[model samples]
Target: MAGDTPRAQPPPPDPDPGGHHPHLLFWRWRRNPLRRRTDRLHAWIALGLLLAVPAVAAAAMLAVGDTAYRHYRSAAEHEARTRDHRAAVLVHDAPRHPEPGSDEAKKARYPVEVRFPGPGGETRTGKTDVEPGLPADSTVLVWVDSAGEITDPPLTAEQIRSRTMGWAILAFLGVAVMGLAAHGITGLVLQRRNLAGWEAAWAVTAPRWCRLP
Candidate 1:
């Protein structure tokens, strides 16, 4: 018997029969007596809300986006009401060909002197931007308020859609940021709670686990 080779011993089983192994990854969900009610609550939160994080964030984004777009549309409509489309005559001749160095050459629009009717039907003159290449006295449709002050042109359908989409994206990003913040805070809270739980558990179990038989 002494000359026989020793048989290979099986690995020791985990001391906590309810837990999977020495490493306690899911010890809270295991059927262990040491697991507290708070442990179950935290476990359920991690499990039940794992998919909900993105879903809630997306829903929040949609709600905020709808509100933002409605406000934007209302403002745009108000602007349209305050502004009128009317023709203004150019007082100075437009360049036949703007120099490449000019902003007009790149943008194809130019600020030039123009005269138009005021609210009182009197001629009013001011420098306003226009599309390039129109000669002097050329009548160009522009947006003007009742005060005869130049204003931004009304939003085209494309412009409205673009603005709506831009605002929606911004809203979506904002919600996503808030969602991420919430997830981070929840993680920190869970981490602290889990650390405290481990400390409490170790206080009771460490002596047994570490004692030499």
Candidate 2:
């Protein structure tokens, strides 16, 4: 029995059954009979999206942010030019009611009548919201336009900056969402095509491999 040669052992099982290393990037671009045209197209699409999404998002954010900042700053400057702060005296006591100590309550205002000097040096009376519980004849500062009408204070530099940042963030998020959606849709279409191709190839080869009588 010792005279017979031992049978040769089969080669060890391949760690990567597909013959492609797991660490390899862009393996679909490699020349292989198993790789299909759709595989290359999918790889190219993924590569383009990887490089394009961030660039497009940054551009959109900058463009929208610049436009918003300019518009807000111009409006604020115009308001500052046409409006002025003047001392006003309350005509009647401001009505007060009990409220919780919350941010909403802190910012709450009540309507009260006040008299202030007009642009022509004459006294003008108007209704405006002010802190509650103020006694009659209390002096307060109010913003008035050229026509002596009570108006809101002009936007500050901080407000303009915040508005610009908000718009920029929105633009960035919008572009990111669109890019992700496009990539997902393309992946689905390519996957379907790949499945169809595999099924057709298998249909042609199955009969040859299984020879019927």
Candidate 3:
């Protein structure tokens, strides 16, 4: 009678005893206190985000550069408004006998120095011969100075124009690129373990026909 009674089939085994679900992976990675390939991928992404430091540095330089240019321009404008008179004097007179070991006497002789007054009783002196061998008239940038003092420095050279924005934009772009690259690298790293495990599991569970191909 026992043999005649049909034997109940054993319950089928689970498809994934290893628990290969995405949610499970996430939970295990978070709470199981074990580092996995997925975790390493995430760490790589974090490192990429850390690259933003270079971008921030670029941004700071942009800000400082703009501020410096503004100050220089202001100084130049003030100087022009107050200039009383400018003269072209050839540098000729050297003390009959240069003071021995005197710092003042050793000062460089500019064939011509442009002397100008500054705001708040300051005196500013700049070399007139900016381009050696060029005519004096071509080298001087004389502005109308009615206030009698140099209020500003010269406009920053044209080379510095738009550089601030360029740097800031470059920083933003760099951060973006770094972030994307890190994310991709992390994904690739994790995929190695995930794919290998998947293949092994498939081999054990699938029919013989699906084994290799």
Candidate 4:
């Protein structure tokens, strides 16, 4: 026995199909004769979850944005209608103003002044820093003869840009979630393949040793 080269042993028989080795169900399913039908089902389940979560998030953001924009625009138009009798005109367009705190600053805009029409068609003027940049020819809802010019709080262009950035972040998160889901599915498939190969190798080696006299 010492001089003889040990014959390589044949592997042990595979575990009974009903035996409870961890991941045994996975092996049975993967190596089942009807692999195509079972594989399709597994593929659909993983792919469906991978797609559905991100799609739902993106749809939610779109719906919220649309509803809010519509409400804001409608309110702006309504305010314009109420000032119709006060001889107000909307500024059609304004030139882009120079950035504040720039070297080329001309006379800085003081509080915007407003004047309204009074009972005898008299006009009064008032001043405040609030001004929605109006074109030189634009007049907004105002009682020009009764009350002084009124300044409306200006909504900065920067604020609008910030709001847009927020929406983009939500969109990016949705995309990231999709990427994670895909990565997880790939990892699961790889682990199962490795496990099956290990089991196959063991099936061959274990039986050979067990059968030794």
Candidate 5:
């Protein structure tokens, strides 16, 4: 009988009777003899920051977006009122070829001389850029400001929306960064305080335990 191989042993039993993993979600808030006041404070602070960060970021984004939209809209309206389109006669033909190796050679539009009535009703001659192949005396429309100086057109609605969204996104990211920074700082401070508290507590308890036996 002793020469026969022994049967395999059974595994150890689980420490927890219910066979459930420890609950972590609100563990800091749960009542426990080992849980400290600092732990509770940390839990509350974490919860508050979790809720506050997105709320603040969203509010800042909306405020900045609205302000940017209004500012751009007002400027567009002003430009519309102060600008005009006028027909001008070309005094000469657009160059068939741009000067070799010149910056104009890379441009899609070519500058040519043109005559138009000024704001004072006097005939004025200035250079305006246009597509190539226009013959002399050809009439073309150009944007002119209140002073009759050639200028760019106003910002389109799409441009305004794009710019507004850009500013809003930047603001949202800025607020989120600040919130993260604040949370990190708070965590460092709390960690130091908790460590100090544990050290002090251990200093008091260690001597008593040492003297017991």
Candidate 6:
């Protein structure tokens, strides 16, 4: 019974190429005595960039979109509030101009002379754009400032969202371009290191092979 001690287990087989060789995702990270220092370093950097590129791109998209939304919202809100909209009557028939790709396949815009009441109830006249085929005496909403100068309407919520998204898309593409460039540069460096390692090993072993014959 005293001699019944458990037998010492044989050391586990080396995970090297001799056995069931599993294809590793990052072979350089695996424990191998022959792996060169620079080779290992390059592998680590490659892995880092693979993980970091997408993360940075997503972050840039969010950051850029948020910044653009804030700026556009502020400017649009101020402009919308400062601008005035009034009901105006057409004084003369709208000018007809044919437009390409319009649903009607013709003029989409008509430059009409419009008349509207000022703050003091006096009639004011100006040239404004309207839908084609509108006759004189038709009513339309006119956008203007306090000084009676015509201006564009404020940005709607949908428009703000679209503008922000567009800018974010551009930023995402830019990030992707930069990431690809970094990846390409790193790959070239890794190739150079690999070739240098091969040359060094060959230099040491070539003389030994010559002595064998």
lDDT of each: 0.71, 0.83, 0.49, 0.50, 0.79, 0.76
Model 2 C-alpha lDDT per residue in residues 1-213, reported as the tens digit of each score: 433333333222223435377655556778876667876887798789879999999999999999999999999999999998999999999877477466676777899999999999999999889887789999999999988899999999999999999999999999999988998898678767777766676667655655645
Instruction: Give a tens-digit lDDT track for model 3, residues 1-213.
Output: 322323233222223335587565434235443445455556555555667656665666667667756765666566545454443332333222245456654543334455544444565665443323333333254332455432334444563455545655665666667667766676565656566665665555545433344
- Candidate 1 vs candidate 5, TM-score winner: 5
- Lowest lDDT sum, 10 consecutive residues, model 1, at 5-14
Looking at candidate 3, the ten consecutive residues that score lowest on lDDT are 88-97
lDDT of 4 at 38: 31
Give a tens-digit lDDT track for model 5, residues 1-213: 433333322222223324265765566778877666766786788788879989999999999999999999999999999988888899999876556445665566788889988899888788899867679999988888898888788889999999999999999999989877877787678767767776666666655555533
Best TM-score goes to which candidate?
A: 2
Residue 115, candidate 4: how far off, in angstroms?
Answer: 4.0
Rank order by TM-score, top first? 2, 6, 5, 1, 4, 3
TM-score per model over all chains: 0.63, 0.71, 0.32, 0.34, 0.64, 0.64
- What ordering of candidates by lDDT runs from best to worst? 2, 5, 6, 1, 4, 3
TM-score of 2: 0.71
In candidate 5, residue 41 scores what lDDT? 83
Give candidate 1 regions above 4 Å deviation: 1-42, 95-107, 196-213
| RMSD of candidate 3 to true structure, Å | 16.5
User: Using lDDT as the measure, which candidate wins?
Assistant: 2
Ten residues in sequence with the least summed lDDT for candidate 5: 8-17
